[model samples]
Target chain A: MRKIAISDGDIQVSTRQLPPEGPEPKPITPAAKDWMLFLGFAATVLTMPIWLQPLGAAYPDLLQKFAIFGIFAIGFNILFGLTGYLSFGHAAFLGVGSYAAVWSFKLFTMNVLPAMLLGVLVAGLFALLIGFISLRRAGIYFSILTLAFAQMSYNLAYSVLTPITNGETGLQLRGNDPRYIDRAFGVESVGLPQTNLFGIDMSGYPGFYFCAAVLIVMFLIAMRIFRSPYGLKLRAIKSNQNRMAYTGFNTRPYLLGAFVISGMYAGIAGALLAVTDPLAGAERMQWTASGEVVLMTILGGAGTLIGPFLGATIIKYFENIFSALNEAELASAFSFLPPPLQEFAVTIVNPFVGEGWHLTLGVIFMVIVIFLPGGLVEGFRRIGRLFRGRSGKRTASQAEVQPAE
Target chain B: MDAILLQVLNGLDKGGAYALIALGLTLVFGTLGVVNFAHGALFMLGAFCAVALNEALTWEIVTVDPTRTTAWGTPLEVRQPYLEAQFGDFGAFLVDFSVPLAILVAIPFMLLVGVIMERGLVRFFYKRPHAEQILVTFGLAIVLQEIIKSVFGANPIPQGAPDMVAGSADIGAWFGMAGSIIYPWWRIVYFLFSVLIIGIVFAFLNFTTYGMVVRAGMQDRETVGFLGINIQRRFTIVFGIAAVVAGLAGVMYTPILPPDYHLGMDFLVLSFVVVVVGGMGSLSGAVLAGFLLGILQSFASMTEVKAILPGIDQIIIYLVAVIVLLVRPRGLMGRTGIMET
Candidate 1:
């Protein structure tokens, strides 16, 4: 029997292929598979507001973060998971994107379209510059190179580029500053302008929907990339770059393309962050910020299509909900327990949540890395396999008994 | 000329800390093949050791004196540290020397912490990929930093040198420049201490049988194991030694930069840059690069240089590292193909 290897996102499965004399392998339609995935993704994202309420994550600000960071993690997964190249400096792009978006806001209009477009374009260009230098080296050296570049950018943003970045106070909207689009269009002054698309305000539910739609589009693009021939080359590069090199495949362009694309995605996410929050800070570009996205991607499942989204959702939930859980919330959560027990529980658990949320995150990430290297998605796959294997064995036994009869 | 000398001295002092930390990092990486991200955390822990010792040495006892009631009629409280109450002048002298004396506390604490970290968490990650090792260690670092933060609120706690070495020394007079150049006494001491430690480490590695085994294990782990030598234990001890070195560096550094929970992370990336630029697993290379980059950084921070290219000092090390790594992939002194994979 010949081995037929297939990959569905990050998960690879090998099946036995029968000889030509046997019945032909059942034909599978690629378009049908793509359509099914698209439909499922659309339904889940379109109904995020309705579904997320149960998880106490229906708020606009958080919902927007969920979508934005999902985009970021997905982008990161493309480079790291696909090519096996970990870039610690992706936050540089994310920060650059935010800076670009904020600049676009300062120069043009409050429209998020221009901001996002500019953010993505600028970030892509920056990524190209960094990726060119960084891609020259591989392994830990590559990681270090990217890190150094990102750090240089961060340090510059923090100190040197104070005029452009506005230093530590961050770039914020001003009443006196000339917004050219507002001038040309003769838009009247308001208290503080909100980011909008055409006329719809990007706040509350509207903002979440806008972010979700963008997330869906980004997810679709990621899915398309994962299925394309270029995607195959990326996977090949990850599996064996030396062999690919020997086979006359110039890997640099593919690597650079993936890096730029991922960087652009990060830029868009950064733009969305600014669109939702309306402020861009230098701290957004810090190494710790970059580390957080790495944590998200890894904790979710690196190679899987849905893993980044899941990871982003979980991490964002911790950042938003888990961090906000105070004594009162903890008391309410443990109300079912006796009063003394509840108090003890709150006291015990208090250190791992709220301001100590990072500690909890660190512990959880360590546990995940140690116990579940495949991440949360891998756990789901293990459960599925266990059940499927049991049922398949039962069916085979039943078929054997029928043949005996 | 004096300004240049001062800057050079400043660079050496900074480079000393970098070299010491990078030295330990290289030892751990070379011996265990695990990139101990928690290495910086060990340095922070070492500084905290000094802080802890200071707190312990200055443990105060308060007693209410009923005979001395004042103002609102509350009894006057007389406070005396137990050390002072017992030993008086000697206790005061001890408290003055607490920063230097904390080296005693740091060595054992760092060794213990290092051993536990290796046996407990890092042991599992040895056979794993570098990525996994990095992630696990990074997680441990976060956990460690957070624990420190929780214990001691996220603030820089200043630790001072003894009175004798508290202020700047007139080094210019010694050099015949006559007060044109003065340098901090503590900084000079720190530089000498680092040099001494570096010397001791090199001597230990070069002159000892254990060091020979370790060197052999670093070159070929399986072959050393085949020789029936317990290289694993030696490496674990090496890990402890590295931690102690890092800790000692941190302990001394508290006077320069106050001890903080995030101090580890602040230095970690820079230390890693130093290590890579020195060339991974290259001991003498780490030292050379550390001093080179350190001096360059100090020089870059000069008023003239900053005037020409603002904020150059903040990122000069990283910029140098990028250039060095791109131009010479094996680093300045790294043996080729060590960690190329």
Candidate 2:
């Protein structure tokens, strides 16, 4: 009984003779998008080692860093991208996690499982304490408070806490470090203890696979959270906390919740770092390191499920691969070009690689922030739209509305 | 008592540098509402300007001396500054005073840099989020630092004060306490210079018609615009002035702390803390808090304090900041409802 009419160059529906509603509009299953995104992310993670070999980033160390920092960025996105609380102190938790892991190794067995669990638990507790104080203020004040706390932590860790943090040398396992679990189990002392999970060595290919598996699990958890009702509430806080408040939502608890979760994620990342290298340094908690995570989250397209990981991978690639491009490597890279052209290219590109990699990163940061505020995710979306627009007979309006799904 | 006096003097001198940087930071924040993470870089550029001027004044003309040879049988190269060759004693004096002379160069350069940065980048970010402003400026700071690093390398380049002021002044002797309370002559000069510059900035802001308009714009930009004033243009000029102030501070500070790529970052965090403690957008508060924190830091660094607290000096400023934030929230002189959200 409904009539669809074209009026004023727009389609209008007249429902005067129709019923009010039609079977609840089929509920618009949100999990479909989440599941699709998760699968895509999983595929990428599983195949990165194989695919990235051509890009000269296939080393175990680089891959491990990618996975570890991916977790850091993902956790950071939860608090920053989703909730809009820009913390300058997440590194404090990361440092704490590392210290906790190393201390676990010193006191107990070299089993990474217990060490990682301790790291997460300690970091979560630390976050709760910090979040309690910092969440009292919102916006810039919140950022400043977090910064102050972090600075205090850094200063203490570098000096007053030297006995525990080992002053600038960082926390490392000594030969005489008490391994209570190993001693009780009647295991003899080796030259140097390495992190192992159920007798599987946490280094090289196996180590990467272990980290990759953990990353997938973490990613799945993040995906679930993104789809959950609580994540929607966090987004609501980001969009407009005042309105959310008027609707009887206590935003502070939710914000605190996000902060703690993110902090724990950083903790896990820190623990994994220790598992890979078995050392924890005070420099890990510096503000610059904190800033690095922010850059990664933003660069990868914060708020998206896979964007943080992508950002982490890209930044790590730059740090590891691009920074390693010596003059010889550059000359080899452009060897196919004519002699003059090759020299010219090397001259032009020389300042932005090797020791000048930071300059390249800075330029990229500025350009991305200025041009692509949504980061690489927005770039991908635009490319997707362009291809779809060319391949299909869809109208511009239809293409615009497609993202609403 | 003399030790206490000496510590007080040290605090006041340190406070002077902190106040100048924080004053500029507060001025920009008050007018433009942008948290300039690159302001420290501007200060670093100023220090480098002094370095550049020194290098320029000391440019050498080397010639092989036919009359002399080294133990290795190489010709002894006699080097004379090109300036000295041209202007004799005047060139030597100029080289000695290069740091002070560089103020002239730094002022115009910093102003231009500030204006270009504002117009080219910050102008677009006016309506954007503060986070974007921070991020963009942070990126700029990194680029600026890296550029300087490539040019200057990673080491701190030392700059010395003129020979006449290199030694400690017996200022206490004037008051019959010379033996106990001596301080560096250059530090006193630096302090006086800071006060003079601060006075000029205050006078400029308080007494002039331009200052009146700027102050009004700071209060209510739309109202000032409605009155037919170009507030945005004025704010750009203020940003330039802020940059100049920071640059001049850097110029003067070269003797106290050597110019380095990371110097700006080290000062920036502390200056931000000063601004917050002074209360955001309150120039007077920034000045007062700068001195207060500076003195407090000096006292915390005392051997006795160290004996008791054991490295409290390193964290005293941050600790005070945290406490101040918790207790006051608006800072020492922060206005109501600004940046509270």
Candidate 3:
């Protein structure tokens, strides 16, 4: 029933971590890197909302929401992309962070910074617990185990932890609960220097600027991690886990560490959301939510630095914006058309838009998987390669192959 | 004593559903090696089949005769013989006989769904990693559920048994019993019906020519193909059979628990854990694990146990799965050659 391996082949498919003794790859010059990053960021600052604001039909709302989700997906990609271990329970960590942040607002404070930190810390702990048990298995079995854990967390949150999570009623601010850190009524909170943190009055540009600052800081840290030696080790483990184990390296610690760190990143995003909304619910922890991020990462282009942002934006914006196009809205929009044409437009576009957004998403996802396979990022590179021919071929390869392998 | 007996009876009925769904899943996984994340959706489709049949059976007047009313003043006509005969006395009861009639009609549609799903979506993922297969099927299941929700709003549609089976059937006196058991008669009928269907499936797989081919194919698809047997056709038929089993389970399941858009998701996660703990591709193993897990869960929910622990019921099944995975990775009855860890 089996054949013995007489020799190793040219494919060199080693299931182990690469040797640590191998020459440590030279670091990118900080000056060149900072220059590259700053130039790109500067370009984005100039082009955003102002240039995107007048896209007429689409709205800057679309771009703004996408950026938020992109952050979520990017954090997730750090765990799944680098480690090659898919976590079905990652959403639990995010939900835990959200609940923590919201609870902070509910009990101690409305200050965004504290709420965000607490959310991240709580999510990190949850990830630690789950990863400790589940990381015992590998491949598909490991994924299923994590899945079971997530479902368990979801059920417990919805039903048993109803008092804490407020169950299906969802926790909302009715201006009743005593929030300790929230109100100065005059001075700005830590989140924004202009308004009170909780009941604080940091209402105007100050609050927006605070959130933007946090996003920029998070982006910088992520970029640093992406280029660091630690990141290279993570990729080595991802490619050949068993080989690493046999090479006298305890791969578990590295893998688990990456998982917890990524989970903390998700927590930060969750905290930001909760502090912004000041509410948390068990629905945030649903299995569907986990699936949503997976869709975002793959759809945007997994592993690429910028891919997660693009993916997250598409999904989140679609979620918020698409839901706005209700049947009444669709019907009303076609009102100026000819009677026959108006009725036809309503019937044809109705199912694929608005309440039918999930249908559109599922269709797009399937098409990408089958045709483009590498996702939106790949699709862009392909166009660029066509004109440059010999010169652009390598540029195209760098983008596509780097993200994939 | 009565409470204990009632709980045991309840457990058996619940276990019947668990066993049937797990059995079909095991059948698919064992031969086709698919985890079948959409199996629960198939079960939901089966329940909706009953709903479809119920809609189709709206009574119409045929040969209306004044004499048919007698004292009730309701115009009687020759309705479908099944509903007319079953609900002669208690026509006003919540149990719509149309749902029961739909069970038979739904089988063909369920089989078609099974075939179409496998050919259209599942076939492409056969060579892919298990995660990819799970992801794609999971997507399909969500789409299916949402489509159903959009079409029929997310509410638990109440479908009951026929009038005669609406309330408890007193088997009290037969076993030297003292009081009424209070078990719904339809549940009793459903339990017996499931056993019969399980028997038929077993016989079809164990004693027939098709069964022989499928069994051989399960062992080695390539060898079966090499031997001039059409493994693809056999797999299709096996899939059809698997779907029918799940559908029957769903149809009979209607009265016990009303069907809802989210009902499938609620059942699917646990059933998957069941299949895994039972061992992939082990039908008998799934049946054994299903009943055991069901009974254990009921015991976990008991007040006696809750006296010590507050939320024992929710974690019991998952805890057991973790323990089982640690102790016996291949499951108690797992075949040596099939998905051995």
Candidate 4:
């Protein structure tokens, strides 16, 4: 055998030379990869009506919810996923956005553009005020502070601010309301003016496309933020805030910026809700609504770019599809079995569907939090790794072992 | 003077309920380091225990009596409660006092629930982040309330106080007041019951050796564990005790607020505010903050106050919570670095 020269005890020196440098290789750069991701996301969202048809979720109302809540969850992820600040008052902003949009429809014009702008502006201001007070404390304190402010707003909206909010009846488009823009333009309608994008009514497929476009744009912005230096600073804040502070980094402005942006996103979603439905209810500001956004973020994988969107889609799908499954439908579905067995199956499955959809949601949420803390995205990654064969396994094991050294 | 006194009384009654719930919350937070979002569910379960017991006691045996005919020419039905038939007066007494009697059943049932939850779920989450703990417990809360909703339906079930204490009491006479200061008799009973439970818990924690070890564990689990103590077991028992306290509070509160499936959620948010305002891990602080917020809430609801500040009562508890959190970052009696991270 040839004599082997050992360097540093553990290293065996080999007489191998590195490969020679070649001409600059054409590679898929990070920018190109991001562009691919954006295209893929846009394709998925734009074609949802086609793909989601098989799942019975292609209707305008449910599709609109998917887009609206997708935007909400994406915005929430920027704050909760990156900064690790769990604000339980985000629904207040959503409610504010809806109210602003409705008021815009009543006073300005039936066009969605001005309504959305006003909604976002009002929501941003509200977020600035709440975030200023709540960001003073960290951890659970911050969550409670946000929750308190939201509850206060909810209560005020329900009672004291009835004149502005329209109270329990919720703010709705009135036939006689002075639409100055529409009036000045000499555009008069016989019935309640439908919320529109110029001349296109925002109640059907066209509306879905509009919301889809906004969702795609929001997703692109979120993706940009994820890959940007600001996102890296946010991730740093999440990992270790004190260390960042020690490094002379002022994290407050960054946090406030993320918060206001997320609030504006929620506002846009609220405006979209009014664009489709033209109503704003105090119930939208309830803590449960806030919790729903939180659940969507966590269920989709908070830190991941597309996780919240996926989560919102899954939840809204469940809300619409599962809840619509009545006893009669379930009974017929199980009619192929023997009478006794069929009855047993229906009884067993009854509480998890129909009016009991929330139970299933709770169970799924618990299971996800317990087993897959990284949410469905993490589950998908695990499954993908398993299918990638021995080479993938070897790399994963190597990655795991490298940490020890 | 009477109005102020009445408001104060109203505050005390509400405070009793708040203190009871917040006390258990603080205990669990202190010993287990778990933020149980399902504590409110435990209280709701306790109230349902009363409903269940009442339903059981009043379960009627219906028989068609051929001797008597109905208007439609069918045999008349005679219904007698199984308990009343078996135990006579005692069974009737049981039905009448089922709300109070629920305390007996709820104690053991809630203890088992608390222990099961600790061993099966919460213990595994002890090492997780507070956010995860809150999320998991919140999911559990939803699961519990949903199950209750399925069983009880979506409406509030009315539970009655015993006939002996159902009427309003002349408390003004006892206080030597001018105007008749009337209050519900059951409310007085609930207030007393809460004080008794609070006293018992305090005495148990402050007087017993087991309590001493648990308190030690709360302060420094590692040190206590290093001393050859099974701090984990003690913490589990502490959790059971906390559940018992919350359950009893619920059991007694049914007559005041009918036990609905959503009752727990309504209280859950406010109780959290109470806990945070009292401080994260301080028992006395929790109790103090509970009463303080309760009193403030009742006073805010006064017509005079509402006239000055519209919707003050609706948001007073949360307002106090926000103010307290901002002014005293650690809360009234919160120790430094408990849940600061």
- Cα error, residue B289 of model 1, in Å, equals 1.1
Q: Report how closely model 1 matches the true complex, as a DockQ value.
A: 0.76
> TM-score winner among the candidates?
4
Total backbone collisions, model 4: 0
The full ranking of all candidates by TM-score, starting with the best, is 4, 1, 2, 3
Q: Could you tell me which 10 consecutive residues in candidate 3 chain A have the lowest summed lDDT?
A: A1-10
Measured against the true two-chain complex, the DockQ scores of the candidates, in the order shown, are: 0.76, 0.72, 0.36, 0.79
On residues B1-341, what C-alpha lDDT tens digit does candidate 2 reach at each position?
A: 77788888888878888999999999999999998989999989999999999988899999899889988999999999999999999989999989889999999999999999899998889888888888888889889998999889889999989988999988678878867788998899888998898999999999999999999999999999999999999999999999999999999999999999988988888888899899989999998898899889999999988999998999889888888888888899998787765
**What is residue A402's positional error in candidate 3, in angstroms?**
11
User: Residues A1-405, candidate 1, lDDT per residue (tens digit)?
Assistant: 001123332221122234659765554445566778788987897788889889888888888889999999999999988898989899999999999998888888989999999999999999999999999988877887888988999999989899999989998887765779977898756677888998899999899999999999999999888878888789889878999999999999999999999999999999999999878998999988888888999999888888899999999998887788887999999999999999999998988888888899899889988999888887887676578897655544543454223
TM-score of each: 0.94, 0.93, 0.84, 0.95
Which ranges of candidate 1 are over 4 A from the true structure?
A1-30, A335-344, A390-405
* Interface RMSD values, listed in order for every candidate: 1.1, 1.3, 2.1, 1.1
Across B1-341, the per-residue lDDT of candidate 1 in tens digits comes to 99999899999988999999999999999999888888889989999999999989999999999999978989999999989999999999999999999999999999999999999999999898788888888999999999999888889999889999999998999989888888899999999999999999999898999999999999999999999999999999999999999999999998999999999998888999999999999999998888888999999999999999999999999999988888888889999779864
Candidate 1: docking tier? medium
Per-candidate RMSD, Å: 4.5, 4.9, 7.6, 5.0
Which stretch of 10 consecutive residues in model 4 chain B shows the poorest summed lDDT?
B171-180
- Which lDDT values do the candidates have, in the order given? 0.89, 0.87, 0.71, 0.90
Across B1-341, the per-residue lDDT of candidate 4 in tens digits comes to: 88898888898878888999899989998999888989999989989998898898899999889999999999999999989889999989999999999888999999999999999999999999888888899899989999999999999999999999999988888889734799999988988898899999988889999888988998889999999999999999999999999999999999999999878877878888999988999899888888888888899999999999999999999888888888887788888887764
State in Å the error of residue B174, model 2. Answer: 4.1
- Steric clash pairs (candidate 4): none
Could you tally the backbone clashes for each prediction?
Answer: 0, 0, 14, 0
